[model samples]
Every structure is written in C-alpha cells, then in structure tokens.
Target: MKKLILTVLLSLSGVVAATAQPMCCYNPVLNCIATRTSVRQYAPTAIPDSVTTTLLQAAMCAPSAVNKQPWEFITVTNPEVRNAIKQAIPNSHAAKAPLCIVVCGDMNQALEGQARDFWVQDCSAATQNILLAAHSMGLGGVWCGVYPNTDRCEALCKVLKIPANVIPLNVVCLGYPDPNAPAPTPKDKFKPAKIHVNAW
Candidate 1:
C-alpha cells in the first residue's frame, strides 16, 4: 500500500512541476534554425514598429571583434528612399517592402591579422541576427549583397550620403510575406574533391 501511495505522489509531483513553470519566450535559437527563408516578395502591409525594434535588438546582440561593434544600420522606409534602394540593387526585383536595412561596416576598425577583416564577419553576424529576428517575429525578409560592386556602392553612397569610413555590406528587404512561398531545402552535405581530411 505504501509503495502505491508513494508512486502516486511522485506522479502528481511530476505533473505539478511540469505545470508550475511558465512557458518561456519562443526559442530564438530554434527559430533561427528552423524558420528562416529568403523572402523576396513581400506583402504590401507594413511591419509593426515593435517587431522592427526586436530585430534591431537581435542585430545589436551579434558578436563583434574586440567588442568594437563596427556595424551601422540604415533603415529606409520612406517611399522615395525605398524606390531609390530598389533601383540601386540591379539584381533584385522591385523592392515593394515597407522597409529596408542597409548593413554597413566601418573600415577604420579592421585591425591587422585579427580575423581577416572583422568588418565582413561582424557585419555578416549582425545581418544573420536581423534575418533570424525577422523570422521569429513572423516577418519576411531577404539579404541582398551590395558591397563588392563598386558602382552600386558609389551610387548608394551618393544617395544616402554615407561617409568614407563606412562601407556598405548588404541590404535586407523586410516586410510581411506576400504569400505562402516554399522554404528552401538544405543543400547536400557531401564533400567535394577539394575537401581534404587531415592534410591537403
């Protein structure tokens, strides 16, 4: 009789323990892994300011070299600036989204031999944070490369009046998703001939 009573108590205790704790925030890390997709076509509706704030906060949390945090974000939401950004990215389809984030890296903080230009990696991490945060917030977005193309960079510089120290890294087009687009599947993990184990 005592054994059965103890088992019931243990079971009840387990249930109470499980129900006692409140649910936590949506797992940002898991959201980052599962729910990310490049969303080019956005719905006409504008994203809420609170959602945008969460995304920017995520970007700010990204790791930086020596804590320099050499990244700057320029948001273009005005219709005119959005139109100008659409024109700037020759490869992108018409950016009809309500907002775009220009991720820029400061060249002045690129220390010698320390992670081979932290600007690129640091900015990339920030961009990834923005992407993940957007996904978590139920917003659609896509990252468009911009820096390498000198013509595009120059054009944006002139348009946005960016200083010389700040170099454009990428542009993120963000807004509500237009429709149910299929998520991209993971690429094959098979290694190629170039991938050598131990030694080349």
Candidate 2:
C-alpha cells in the first residue's frame, strides 16, 4: 500500500511540475518579429486566396493619421503585369515573387490642409503591417520602394493603369522562401549611443 501511495504521489508531483510551466515561455509574436527577414528569393509555390485575404486584413488594421485611412492595396498575380513591373524596376527582385501587393495612398482620401501630408506615413505603416503579417504566416516578403522615385512610379502607374489621385507607395513581394537559399543572419541592431535621456 505504501509503494502504491508513493507512485501516486510521484505521478501527482510530475503533473504539478508540468502544470507549473509558464504558458508564455514561448511568445509567438516575439518569435515572429525576430525571425522575420527580408526574403528576396522564393519558391515556385502559389499563395492561397485565404492567406491573401488575411494579409490584406492585417495591412488594413494599421492606424492612420487623424483617422484618415487613405491606403489602398492592389494584388498583382498575373504573369504579364508582374513582367511589366519587373521591366519598370530593373533593380528590384520582387518581380520573381509568386505574389506582389502594391500599396497605394489616395490623395482624395487624405485629410485637408497640412494633415494631408501624413498620407505617406499612414500608407507606410500599412505596408509594414503586411510584411510582418506575411512573416508571421511563415511566408517571406520584401518591400520594394516606388513612391519617391518619379520614373519608377510613373512607369508602374502606366503599366498598372493607376488613377491620378492614387499613388503607388511600394510593392511587397511575397512567397514561400526557397529552401536551398541561405538564411540571413539576424544582427544586434540595438545601439546605446542612439538613445538620449531627455534632449540631444
């Protein structure tokens, strides 16, 4: 009877130990953020429509300036359109991605007066959200700049037939990462010198 009681106590102790383990020991958000690296190379697999919708939902959830959400998204999956975009920006490797999302800002939707200038910032936030969401979903993505460059912007606008009021900010190239490709090393970017106590 004592041996059986000892076995029961041991089992209870094991259960207690297991239950004592912290649930937050593995933080998915932090893991996702840390593991997120710009992926220029991708596999040939296609992204599903459900995943695309989730990514767009994540992008749209970003905060805007003065509640003026002026961002728009255009998903380009067609080979012809992707080729044209590639031709427009010869330096960008995003054309090779399985899916490309064009993030845009609408001038008409911007707040009036000086606040209108904040549309770029709002759109940029949305773009970042999309990239983070893609990474969290185990997909890879890279942000290819477009808005500031007049030539590149004009070329994309012409190719995509974008409207006058809407400005393409950037293109997010997304896909499953190529397994053969080398993973980028995560760097320690924290700098104590960059921090200021009160004023510089």
Candidate 3:
C-alpha cells in the first residue's frame, strides 16, 4: 500500500518475513532461518529505528577471526544515494529497497599478513546474521556482493566516500516485502549427500 495506498511510511520501511506462515508456528530462530528468502520486490514504507538497531546488533554479534571484528555497516535510506549506488553495479537492487545496509571491512583493523583474508569470512558471517535478523523481524532482504568485484568495490568506494582502509563487502537491500508480488516457494537446500563424517 505504498504508491497505490498510503500506509504510515516511516524512514526505514520494514516487515515481510512470511505472510503464508503463521507467526505462532515458528521457533523464532529456526523459523527465521528456515523461512528466510531473498526478497526483491519491497514496499516503500520506512522502518523503525529500533528495528534497524536490532538488525545491527545481531550483525555485530557474529563471530570473527582472531577476535578481529573488522566489519562496518552503512545504512542508507536516501533515495538519491541508493540510486547512485545501484548504478554502480549490474543487477543491483540496492536502490529499489527502502533501506540499503552496506557491509564493509576495515582492513586497518584486520589481522596481519597471511591472515588478512580472514576479514572476508568475518564480514560474511556478519552479513548472514543481518539477513537472518531481518527475516526474524518480519522484514525481507537480499545480500548483494561487492567485495571481490573490483569495479563494484571501487565504484562504491567513490560513491560512499569510503576511505582507503575500508572495503565494502556487500550491500544488504532491505524493505517490507510487496504484498502484491507473488510469494515464491522457499528453496530446500539441505543435502544429505554433501555431508561427510569427520572429514570429506
């Protein structure tokens, strides 16, 4: 009810975990993980600050390598800024969402030498936490990669005014799922054959 109808539009448009699933049915955490899906179509209403805070708190709780939590999050709600970022990447929906959280790695805070690559894993874990947290909060989001792609990284750096020491890992596009869009079936990724007993 964004363009067609007026709902109370806040600054952080939020909600839309799963309309099909009953709220009383999930075991909170497990429900979030199991029902989570990548949402592209979103309502334009803004989310509450408290909800955003919860998402960030969950993200920061992620474990890091060598205790080096070198992740940085840039929460974007400005339409112009989001559009600018969208233009920087191919097939990016960052601009479409009501809020775009850009997760970055602070290389300066990362471990030294051979362990430098650990920042990637650390940041990735943080991203996953955000995604799950969003779902749990009844919000929909998708992870848009940025780190490994040189063009994207560089472009984002310029757009976001990121310093030389920080690297944007990915963009978490978030918003309330559009009620009108058809809900797709959630994928079942469990693979018994891939499991190995002690080692592969």
Q: Which portions of model 1 miss their true places by more than 4 Å?
A: 1-28, 112-116, 180-200
lDDT (Cα) of model 3 = 0.88
**What is candidate 3's lDDT per residue for 82-153, written digit by digit as tens?**
999999876779778999999999999999999998999999999999999998877999999997999999
Q: Candidate 2: global Cα-lDDT? A: 0.88
Write model 1 residue lDDT over 1-200, tens digit each, in one string. Answer: 99999999999999998875423235657536554778877778877778778888999899998888889989888888877877888765335878888999887776557564777888899999999888777787888898888988988887788999889998898887777656555343334786988999
Off by over 4 Å in 2: 1-26
Compute each candidate's TM-score over C-alphas.
Answer: 0.74, 0.84, 0.85
Superior by TM-score: candidate 1 or candidate 2: 2
RMSD of each: 8.0, 7.9, 14.6
Instruction: Count residue pairs with overlapping backbones in model 3.
Output: 7
* Rank list by TM-score: 3, 2, 1
Model 2, span 69-126: residue lDDT tens: 9999999888778988889877666667889999999999998887887999999999
Winner on TM-score between 1 and 3 is: 3
